[model samples]
Target chain A: MIEVQNISFAYKKRTPVLKDFSLSIAPGGIYGLLGRNGAGKSTLLYLIAGLLKPDDGKVLFNGVDTRLRKPSSVSDIFIVPEEFDLPSISLKKYLSLNSRFYPNFSEEDLHRHLDTFELTPDLNLGALSMGQKKKAFMCFALACNTPLLLLDEPTNGLDIPGKSRFRKFIVSSMNDERTILISTHQVRDIDRILDYIIITETNRVLFDQPVSKILSRLKFMTTDKQQLIEDALYSQPSVGGANIILPNTDDIDTELNLESLFEFALVNPQALIDAFTNNINA
Target chain B: MIDNRFRISRTFDLFRLYIIENRKFLLICAAAIVGILICVAISIASDVSYKRAYSMYRPDLDPAIPYLVPTYIIIGYIFAALGASFMFSELKSKQGRIRTLMVPANSSEKLISRMLVYVVLYTVFYVLAICIAEFFRDIYLMAKMTVAPVTPLYTIFGNEAAINFLTTDKYPILLPCILFVGVFAIQSFFVLGSTLWYKYSSVKTFALFFALFFFYTISVFMLGSSLSEGKTYNNLDHFMSNYFGYVFLCFEIIVCLFNWCMAWWRLRETDVITTKR
Candidate 1:
């Protein structure tokens, strides 16, 4: 588990990226952290991973300050930055050198993850394409078996199949003892795989809810009926109809449309908050 | 209670990782050192041959003897300084900084591992390269000379300054200790600078060092002149003559420790994203 307590951070000579922001993530479940460009999604991930220190307050992992970067704390956390470099060495050599730091590293899990991504253990990382390198790095990251995994733009450079394999990789690696917070704007690539959805903006979290609760509170549908559009909480035009979010008054369940939900949260944040708050009251 | 912050096993792991990551660069440095030494040897051989053909040739004259030690010391210092300054070159880029900081080793382990590679191991490699280069130089000289020289190869370890310092100095062991600490202090300064400024670290460190040294020299000169103005004491002269080595050694040791500590602190505070402190 991780706790962000009233933390504020800014780059040199710039406005604060995150101002008095706070977030708590419990163990287990895949979290989809959604935000637009420059929305501080990656900054939040870095702060949680202890790659950046907060100007005020602190981020604690299991009661230990992450900024301290104590071995005991860092060993339990793994981060895959949006852009990274893999050493120009064979996969086996790289694993042999790096895996000893993580006590829970599993070679078996590594092989399985690599298989899911259709990669081999004998890979010469330098010879691989950028996409392949990302896959290889992700496989190793999952195999580290860290309790907290913070991924920034996990599917950024992936091809279509690579993205599909990435989703499978995440699902296969998921367990009750692990928490994976994926920060990405490529919503469709990860929306279906997320257990919880969190939409954030510059200094605030607009919405945070489990997928089941989101479904229970709002209905997502594409309809041509003008009446539904007028009454809809949020609506976006589609080819044949308009995609709309409505209060689930009929008690019917629909698949969560993450794209529409994210748009709704940003456009009418108050309505989104009221929808969830009214349901909790009821 | 065991201190988990400085685990020997983790430090060794990090050391091994650094070695593997930079093995290619190490190999290239070794090759380049050997190549430069051989070229210097070849130039010396050519000059000896020219002397034999055009003027007086003495079988007792060995031209390479004088250049060996100075060459080793000069090249070794430059290489060591440059290597020390580049110890944290990975921190120059955002991606590199992220990868380095995210590795599950403590700052102590990381800094120690880098010191092992760039300082200790590099010195050993440089010495070995000098020996190997000397061997090749001797072979080339023997083939070029009509008369075989009395001394074939000058031993790098048996250099005159080292021998004289060890055998003739009043405090033989203390002099070497001072020299060792002085070397470490210089290297630590470069390492500290590397952490302070990731880009163009070596050049910046050299400029800063010269500036500080200039100011320090002036300050010491003025202070010494004022302090000694009213006093022409034989006691001061005798005390300085007797205790100067010890004082210099202590100063070097303190400088070395301070630089290392500051470097480690800077490394500990490094963030993947550069921001104002």
Candidate 2:
């Protein structure tokens, strides 16, 4: 549903953030964007939303240029940033103002979700805590029911329960017509709902693969022995034992460790790509 | 694929949002207006008498009708407060991201709504305050002159001079309203600048106004210079009052457009994740 073509951006001279970076998301997938600090993930998402004018290339939504006619092109598109504020009015007023701008807003869905968040229509948003504010905005975004939803660091201040509630909301709030892009450094918080993962480093997408494809292409393990398993593409140890990723062979059943896969993709990218490509044809 | 249902005009909701956001404060403004008008009416009725409202005799100089600048200042202050308080509400804090970016309207829509609140709603109330003051002042004047033969109603504000001020002469009622709206549109930018800068945001708000000065100074300066033959800034008054009035209406429209697009550019790319202050 979203197409970004050969886009490159820089905040300052000679300090390239995203160089020749591009990614396309089809309709209905929940994309997890993984990158370290200052990785330009937020910049990329804003480019798609037509919030930022790209230095080069174009972000196209259904064949229309986003930057040139952003309002016309992406009025149905919504972005929820990590740090967001609400108007000082009650939630009822806030929803009225926002929902009018979004023709697709579902008041029934809104009522249901607001109850799930335990937020009343009468509460003034200015007085709510950060987590409460986040929940309220998330509820609104879901109610907007737009075709494209871009959430940046959506789980930052969320409490433990808030995080679990967020996971539930993210999964339940989707349909076949919508695309959700969640960008975060807090990888563990949203691993379960991430059907596809995109890792950015060195101004390029080192890994762009599905969880199932990644699991089939490679294996994850924690072995007490520190033997040189040369067949393994990459290895990193945690507290108890060494966690290794290698080519999946035979009929061995092993779970995928996203964190390890992300690390392996960053350190040994070629091997990671080769394993995925090899399995794609197999 | 879902239908294309997002419309840019949706940002106009900010107009209603702006009023609702300050609905309590607006009622407070209306109260402030009502209170001040009552006090002025009482003071003029009790202390100065009707002879003073229409024709205040200086005994030495000609009679000068008091133009109630204090009332103007009070009315100006309330609307100025409304504009000042919310100018940067969406851009200054985390709420800026939540309200401006996530809504279906886009950045331009958000900005346009804010400008509408400042120029249209606030200025309308300003004129309302003046009308209320004049209406009650007329009643007080009429009541005080019940015993006298020379009713001040002949030359009062809404009397012959009031109707003739526009209908008989060149200036239409639309002239003043246009001027007020146009001047306030330019003044709204001062609030926008406050949003861009943090230290400026915490200042006294409505009590602190460059908006008033900007409005008054431009009008006076333009009028004054135009009257002078050699002045570079021609008085807009020189144009037919109706034509000048139309110019202001057009100017206000353009300003509203500019305000929205500028706000959109500022907000569309905002990193709400880092916008927390």
TM-score of chain A of each: 0.97, 0.92
What count of clashes does model 2 give?
8
Candidate 2 lDDT by residue in tens digits, B164-273: 33332555566556645645564555555445543445354333446654785688558755755546445455544435446657767776566545555655555544
Best by DockQ: 1
**What TM-score would every model get versus the actual structure?**
0.91, 0.75
- Can you list the residue pairs that collide in candidate 1? none
In candidate 1, position B239 carries an lDDT of 29
Q: List clashing residue pairs in candidate 2.
A: A51-B268, A83-B273, A84-B94, A85-B94, A85-B95, A86-B95, B90-B96, B226-B235
TM-score of 2: 0.75
Q: DockQ of candidate 1?
A: 0.53
lDDT of 1 by residue, B28-77 (tens): 87789878877766666555542342224433434455555556666777
**lDDT values for all models:** 0.83, 0.66
Q: What is the C-alpha RMSD of each candidate to the true structure, in Å?
A: 3.9, 6.1
TM-score of candidate 1 relative to the true fold? 0.91
